[model samples]
Target: MATMQSLAFSSPISSHRPHQQRSHTGLISSPWVICQSTHSSFNGQSLQLPQPRRVLLRGSSKLTGAITMMVKPVIQFIQGTDEQTVPDVRLTKSRDGTNGMAIFSFDEPSVFDSTGELGEITGFYMIDEEGVLSSVDVNAKFVNGKPARIEAKYIMRTPRDWDRFMRFMERYSDANGLQFVKK
Candidate 1:
């Protein structure tokens, strides 16, 4: 029945500079930065190619009034299907300031010197806030069975905030059916 929350994907900044082909050309130098990633795959098709990293963490200065941003972005997640824990329970996508908006946290790591890309995370960045739709809380733990991935990306500066966060993740995945996990 088109499960996985009616399917929704693309936020790894559009799989290679794809914020509708971003290139606003202010000379590409604006400190309010974002984008962090880790990737690896097999059956999902990605022998290795999805490792993006960039974080300038826009400077925010405005205490108790209205706008208070704090971005600690770095994403890419895998390991799910558990009522409690196992497979590295994860989700961590952070961003603050520049008004781009981002905050999703759900990661579970008790002890993992390194291990990733087991299964679960296949997509990233889904936001909706008020109605309740925020699933991204970056993650990373290297050196395990030899394959687990997490890749993060964020881009917006007009395109109407990337079409208002892609229509609030497409109405939060068509009102919560949930699909948007990619390699």
Candidate 2:
């Protein structure tokens, strides 16, 4: 068995770099150039002059651009239970670690139940902040001649891919009581 000290020799993860570049900062440009021009009559008219040069458009700070990028995520939530039609669901995230989802559409409740039978089970899904799928499924279980199981699936996801999924889930949940369970 290797001791903790021996195992801690080195890890490639330490050298792992995502190569992230700041869009507004100098990271996006290599060797930025600052140009200046001095006006002179026969190179001897430096008696008096105002400010050297005026900056046209100021470069946005990396922080401001990051804040705006962080604010534009569109997320919605919903919950329901149905069985016949396919449940349309969407998953998304609000912030870095928070999560949410939406329902795209749902079927009528009438189609979910019979005169004396187990009702259909239905729900939706959402994408978490990491861009993984978290789903809510309702299953109506029938054993022999009786209904036995009604279950649901609470899914999970990452932060990156959440937004695209949530827009789809928003519709169905709007029609039914949104059964979103956050972890």
Candidate 3:
């Protein structure tokens, strides 16, 4: 099994020397360019590329076949007395040590609405912003059979909870013959 630490996010192409000129086909034409020329151009310091960080319920798992599920940014909406309000908050998941416990963190408080009412969350939807839905629409395609029981607190907060949610999603996708493709 490949550990998550081994996965690195490498650039599609390596950085070229600043002095190197590009040809018509966008290929570097210089052969004697200084290797550190590009590094010096950026305030005389070489910028290191960011490494891929370990995210909960992400990356390819040999134990779970070759299918890799991506974790995208999601916004949670709360059901109010008469309307739904989108909070200025988002959901994020990270591994808690090597125990496989999914740790969910947020910048803002996890309160549902301004009234401080609990258990008012109706459903989970993939959204880019408050009112704007995600382009993929995972819910519309991946919801079938008996409705999955979703609690406000167990919204991708722990590994067990996340796994349950994922199983529901995978079941729907499998039944509908839909494959999740990474973009």
Candidate 4:
């Protein structure tokens, strides 16, 4: 979700060294300037040094790009014969975006009371780009013998699975009127 542009300094500084070289003791010189040796600590000891080389200075480059990501969208859960969109749901994922948990909270106690009669929630489904995507291993939180919140965990174990998840998210976002935003 990012585009990068690279910019580098391209100019070369002139060395300006004389054709006839003059030798000095323990003197250091750069391409830009020459200075007299101030250190006399090397008492009468001659030092051999390498030839002066040209060095190019470069400017620090930045990414110069903007990264955008889609905010998690509200999801619709289908229970029994009823389908409803729950806005109080949250989708949290790992840093790699592979493993995640979807939590759906229901404020209406009647829905939980009615669904509890069956002893277990069955036919757990979600509306995806296609018709229905079955959700598995859904755990529920019960308060006073009535369900309050439900959590569904998902994992994408591979790149292909991640791609499929992205595709589903793309369509789901379109269906839910969601947009990607820069963080």
Best-matching candidate per lDDT: 4
Residue pairs of candidate 4 with colliding backbone atoms: none
Clash statistics: count for each candidate:
28, 36, 0, 0
lDDT of 3 by residue, 80-160 (tens): 222221111122334351222211122222332232454544444432111222122112111365322222222344454
In model 3, what are the clashing residue pairs, if there are any? none
Model 1 — which ten-residue stretch has the worst lDDT?
Answer: 81-90
lDDT of model 4, residue 169: 49
lDDT of 1 by residue, 6-60 (tens): 1124333212211222122211243343323222121122123233344434449
Query: Candidate 2 or 3, higher TM-score?
Result: 2
Write the residue-wise lDDT of candidate 4 on 59-152 in tens digits: 6843233222222222334344333333233444455544444443444423354554544456445443234445665666778996666655
Rate residue 142 of model 1 by lDDT. 49
Per-candidate RMSD, Å: 17.9, 22.9, 21.8, 29.0
Count of backbone collisions in candidate 2: 36
Any idea what lDDT model 2 has?
Answer: 0.31
Selected candidate, larger lDDT, 3 vs 4: 4
Model 4 residue runs over 4 Å out of place are 1-82, 87-119, 177-183
Which candidate number maximizes TM-score?
4
Better of 1 and 3 by lDDT: 1
